[model samples]
Target: MTLNRQWLLKARPHGMIGPDNFEYTETPIPQIGDGEVLVKNQYLSFDPTQRNWMVDRPGYLPPVGIGEVMRAGSVAEVVESKHPDFKPGEQVQTTGCWQDFAVVAPGQGPMGVNKLPPGVSPEMMLSILGITGMTAYFGLLDHGQPEDGETVLVSGAAGATGSVVGQIAKLKGCRTIGIAGGEKKCAWLTDVAKFDGAIDYKSEDVSERIGALCPNKWDIFFDNVAGPILEAALNHLNLYSRVVMCGGIANYNNIEPVPGPNNLMNIVTNRGRMQGFIILDYLPRAMEAIEALVGWVSAGDIVYEVDIQEGFDNIPSTLQRLYTGENFGKQLLRI
Candidate 1:
């Protein structure tokens, strides 16, 4: 009785992605079997990781095969259900892909479908309360291990995850410094997120700016941009400092092998630690982070932004925004 519009990956990308990489199709809405719930997706979460999913590579999760539906996370409402745990009208989160609807089955592979909390809007759920928030929470607290009065540096600081990481660092009493691409975003970091300092990477010499701002050396380096930014931070690490390798968006689309950070020896010189983490590892304790984040949001200690693009037709083009650095915060497609 319904139609489902879907986007299928038509080809693997060599450089920047475009509409030609996908095949759009429409079919009857999927019917739910026993132990399954039919979801009418409300909001589609656009994340940089979705790019990796499109490639054929060895990674944390298997790559989406050719001609397969592109994978993505979304917030949805159960319109029909046969599962005991889910009921009609309940809002849930699942890997709804680039589609108008999804059939969520129980024990859905890692990041299984789950019910959302009460009273929180879908925007908040997809932004600060969802995977982006959890990534920031765990990446900073559990991995970075920031200390009070210490200096914390965050690359890609105006992004969804980076913004939250900077705020959490500030709330922990650390001096937070953000590295962004332009004057407006840098200003937002300093003026709005209240970062102790912001460096406009597009205009300033990263190494020089960081050397001046963190004269005492940095205690925690949240490396999201990686590459040259990671190298710049490496040149200024304090003894026993912690580096949280959250992401490397700078080279996610690179076809040729990108070289490692040039200042790799700094870790040994400063006797500091550098480690990477995948948020999926902390799924068992996600609610703890979610509750703390919720409390922070409720108390006005933490704030976030969402850059929403309308229509499912724009998913491919909209995703390119993350690569071009055109998206302001959490990028979401309003379905």
Candidate 2:
């Protein structure tokens, strides 16, 4: 009897996504005929891949087809149910897309989200427990593997994954240096996240500041914003250093391809290892990450910074903020 509002892709965006690229419509609520439970979405996640995946080309994941709901992962409360495993009032995580409601099957999605434990809010689940958290945990632990006394450099350090990556490095006894867009973000990174040092990319010479921050050379780099930042980090990479390339927000909106990194010579000189990572591969370790992440959150060792935008209709604008480096931290939608 209810209508579900879903944002469908209208046209593919070449550089940056905008409101015009989507078509929002009110459609009949999907019938939960068998094992499916209908959910009223409470929160949704916005990510950079929405841009990366829509190029009509093949990559690690498939592109979002025209007329399909703009793809997103969401946490919602079950409003109606036909499945015994999921009852009304229960919360779950599913591929909800940019919609006000969804009907998801049991034993589906990254993991069943029928119930969430206490102390983990919907924001925490979608962020720390979802893609952003996994990106930080797997990207740093698996690739960076920063050691005690090491100098760790994290680009986009004031945002979601970079904040956690720097904090995790700090917890492991490494000196964390952050690169963010402004002085405010830089201050938050050092003061709140406990990063040993930071660089405001807007006001300072990133490469020079990094050199001054750590004369020892950066031993591990968790790079979220690539392009020039990646180039800058290369100048300070230590011998056998590791670079975890998570996303390249700077180049996401470029009409032309970002020039090949200008500092490849440093990689050859330092014998550093540059690599890319995706959180999907680390799903099995979700519980392990939650246990550790929760401990940090409760102990005040880890801070969760979320930039929440209200309503499903605002998703496009919210998404554009990620590419502009305008969002201060973890980005999400409050449905």
Candidate 3:
């Protein structure tokens, strides 16, 4: 506990990320300044967007500098506080990075620092009620603007964000169809998450399945996996449909830039709208999403999965799960 163990970005990734992309070392536990707090990260969040953050390019946030701690979201316990609003032993969520300890302050970093609500576990705060949940809530309801009886399609539908998107669409009286990787995930989507139908993109013809599933065409496409899947969804857009661009995990590891969907004209022809969003833009109104999500989850209307990998040694390898389809849901590392 005297030193902070960290995974630093060693080199920018070329294709798929691996252990070599990061360097591990120990440093003195960071000291907190006045109005800052020192937190011991208990869990680390692994996200597809982290791949984008690793590249040396302009993004919503700055890339992790070489030899610097790799940035990540985490649920942590306050170990020491120089800030008046925080106290020791309280659990909070913040941009704790890939380190055992971090110095954080209120209204700092992309996530900033917020206390976990009463009766909310760290896992719940990081997964269903965290970034992914918020993304699903705002992306589908706010951006997609789904209506009753509309056919709602979701890509990456078994992942943290997409699963919730489909469920919320269902709650809003939309017919939900999910596109996931394998039979296992697709089954979970239809059987457990209660989607109207599911398309296993790995085994089935996605465009054909969409046609079968949405006989009337889809009204909203909440896309998390863009690439060929995006093109497929675009092919089946209903008139004046909405496409919520959330994540593009399909091409995140590509060495060369992947081509955009060739069928984007479908949007224009159908008079549809496609909009991309960054969850950070809605952070100020986070509680709005959290409140609604908590109600659904408590009432069993929404169900989410979290894949927790243990031990600090497994940190780098655990992240590879997101791109490799090894993770079933929200990927987190227990420190």
Candidate 4:
């Protein structure tokens, strides 16, 4: 019998998640019931949203209760199947938790297990073609609504979603500015991702730089790292600007209540629209976004990067990179 190694949530995180928050153990691989399939997990996705799932609170999906498998999206190859819908040798994507194997059932909806398309590598499906890409695509186009020659600014700009948002804005004929930490990330944004400007938020004065770079103010602000950066962007929103509220990695680990942006009055003053979105809300239209993204990637109109960590043992420490800004591009684990 295959031994399944799993990470169980041992305690709710008090601040930043630590090794003590999770307990790893080995057990027999789960047997598939009548409609279930057994998947051998190969890649585990590390996302900022997983932090929210760790807290015991209501979210788009219910929080992972204590002692449950640490919830995560993963790509797996089906090794055994009792379900008619799944076949052996097929690769699938699902919330496989932090484990070597997963037992999955279909019809979970929005967040269900499904077969990966042919020719799409596991890394591509998890990064640019997966939830990360979809979030950037729909959030920027549907909500940001950037126009030709308009200035679009994105926080967490070197990350998986934010990077894509900047590129998509550029493709739409908008001038793009990316806000990221460190000179290296900023350079990657302007030099590699091809954004019009890149701000090193860690080293430079963000509001002052925004004032200088975008004298007309930003037409769209796709905010992923919410904190001071959100406030800074809010202070410079142009008339009818749209703010797409994505992940808030800066505040995800805060034990104490964080304050709202003091400059939110700019939203009222400029008649700007700020909206938060859960990507699951756009699931029905995911195929539309996927087709466009695939086409863009195919034609060299879009590019992406992935940071792959090697060991399953490093999952906890790897996740902390999201909060610490140590991770560049889309963070993933090769199990």
Candidate 5:
């Protein structure tokens, strides 16, 4: 393609982000500089955190400036290379944003360009072995510090990261309970993901369900949906429990700051620890998660889902699916 089609940030969101937040444009396919590689994006990744990046504020990464390509992660093919480490036709993962082509270099961008490991497909690299998977591996193991025989609770349990977290906890011999939004997801958590129990937050009373399902209380709460759910989980924590503050998708689209869990004192009383982390902090140790995840997935111990939407025209609408919980797993767009 001679022109690079892109979705540029048109306006900051007030509530839920939608098509109006972006403007479509075409530009010359980006040229690579010396020591850089030019890549054609094949797939785009959509994450709730992208909402945080749209606002003009301080964050782990800078906000995507207005009229700039909307920041995103992508699996791309090396179309031309000026760098020695990459060559034409090799598939790679990089911060390709929402454009048809990008100029990338090793050690540049949040996710510095990396060739996909041999035998790993773009789906695998962007899902179970990508940022979401790495987040689950490190967030649960490093922050949650779960022990065998413990009872683990996961919020947003049907999502790409939370689902993997619960499965890993099960592999470690923990009895896992997942809190999701609908019956279908709840059923998938128990039937497919093999959690000990599932809570449908939309159809059931979350606090009461937690009390019933986790009669022994929980040792670790891997929370992705923070808000009322966090408050509910706090009601049933074992002594010295851990709360892995992963993402707060429940409030990501709020125009104003949502109130935090009113029962944070529960952490103090139970001698529990609640900690938050950005996956970028663990990028240096990414292969540690990747290697282990590959083993588990190959052995059938771990399973992940990717909800892919097609067409460049669907890009903005595809992102809207995340906030509305229309996506079943990892949200991706195939161009």
Candidate 6:
């Protein structure tokens, strides 16, 4: 019945976010109008995308305005409603961003979480059915364009999106090789996720390991962490290869500007095509992809991982984990 407590963005950050960047205060609960509903926030999504908002810059999405709650996807329950579309007891996954609660117009944005299948955890719907899964589905199949008997390479291969990319590549009959940050993550990719092979950038040489993994040269590259790794993949692409430009996790925290890839010429030399997508453009086909992903996951053909931290207050710290590659899978904040 009482509404309040919000974390507001006080100032933008220069590099790594600090506690002073946010100001926690009590706010009023807005009254729902004839077509609106009040939602009680339950979980918040912590993603690499938040880093883009730290600075006042232009990108695929607009930066979060100062004094607004940090922008994020959230799962909440509708506690009060005046709209016919939503009921009080229904739980929906809404954009809570960083606030504890929100007042939103009914039947807008993402899907409603009011109803869920029993035995299905929030991690499944939130991480796998949420944005991360969509990124993998559209980014891999539509952008990467895997072909039969081809070799596919994925950066940040242990991540939620990257992991899904590798599996989809395998399902398409491609040899999936993963490039992860550490030995532990690489082990998870090869052993748990059943990737064809794994590369540890921290210990092994990328060029040498990639050579051994796919001596024929990579045919499809699903890149999540760009920077040098992307250049490496470019240098090794097979003729007429497809390079899917997904997320650039590596560039999320650089204080200085990043230089262009040195091996970009490989695209010309190999006669390859490199394309980037934001997933939003393909939202109309998302449900069809979700259905396929669900079937794959349920059939043991696809594997997913989720690293969830409890509490709404942990959102800032949990998000920081994404930059460090400390999170092995999809990062989520529990409310």
TM-score versus the correct structure, for each prediction = 0.98, 0.96, 0.99, 0.98, 0.99, 0.94
Each model's RMSD to truth, in Å? 1.0, 1.5, 0.7, 1.0, 0.7, 1.9
Candidate 5 vs candidate 6: the lDDT winner is 5
Q: What would the per-residue lDDT of candidate 1 be over residues 1-335, giving only the tens digit for each residue?
A: 66899999999988777788889998889888999989988899988888888889898999988888888899998999999999999999888888988898777855789898888888998899888899999999999998899999999999999999999999999999999999989999998899999999999999999999998889999988888889888989999999999889888878886998888888998889989999999989988998999999999988898999998889889889998899999999888
Model 2: colliding residue pairs: 92-113
lDDT of 5 by residue, 1-335 (tens): 58999999999999999999999999998777899999999999998899999999999899999999999999999999999999999999999999999999999999999999999999889999999999999999999998999999999999999999999999999999999989899999999999999999998999999999999999999999999999999999999999999989999899889999989999999999999999999999999999999999999999999999999999999999988999999999999
Alpha-carbon lDDT, every model: 0.90, 0.84, 0.95, 0.90, 0.95, 0.81
lDDT of 6 by residue, 1-335 (tens): 56566888888876667677787777788677788788887777777777886678897777778998877777777888888777886767767678777887744644333444455566787787777888888888877777899999999899888898898889999999999989899999999888999999988888778888899999988888889888777768899999888878888777787996898888998999989888767767867877888889889998888888887567677778898888878888787
Model 6 ranges with Cα > 4 A deviation: 106-120
lDDT of 2 by residue, 1-335 (tens): 66889988888886677888889898988877787788888898888777876677787777778998777888889998888877898877777888888878866754444466766688988887778887898899989987899999999898888899999998999999999988789889878888999899999998899999989999998888889988888888899998888988888888788896798988888898889877877777778888888888889889878999997678888988998888877899897
lDDT of 4 by residue, 146-215 (tens): 7999999999999999999999999999999999999999999998899999999999999999988898
lDDT of 5 at 20: 96
Which candidate, 5 or 6, has the higher TM-score? 5
Off by over 4 Å in 2: 107-114
- Put the candidates in lDDT order, highest first: 3, 5, 4, 1, 2, 6
* Candidate with better lDDT, 3 vs 4: 3
Compute the lDDT of residue 153 as modeled in candidate 3: 96
Task: Report the error of model 4 at residue 208, Å.
Answer: 0.4
lDDT of 6 at 215: 91
Which parts of model 5 have CA positions greater than 4 angstroms off?
A: none
lDDT of 3 at 330: 97
True-vs-predicted CA distance for residue 250, candidate 3, Å? 0.4
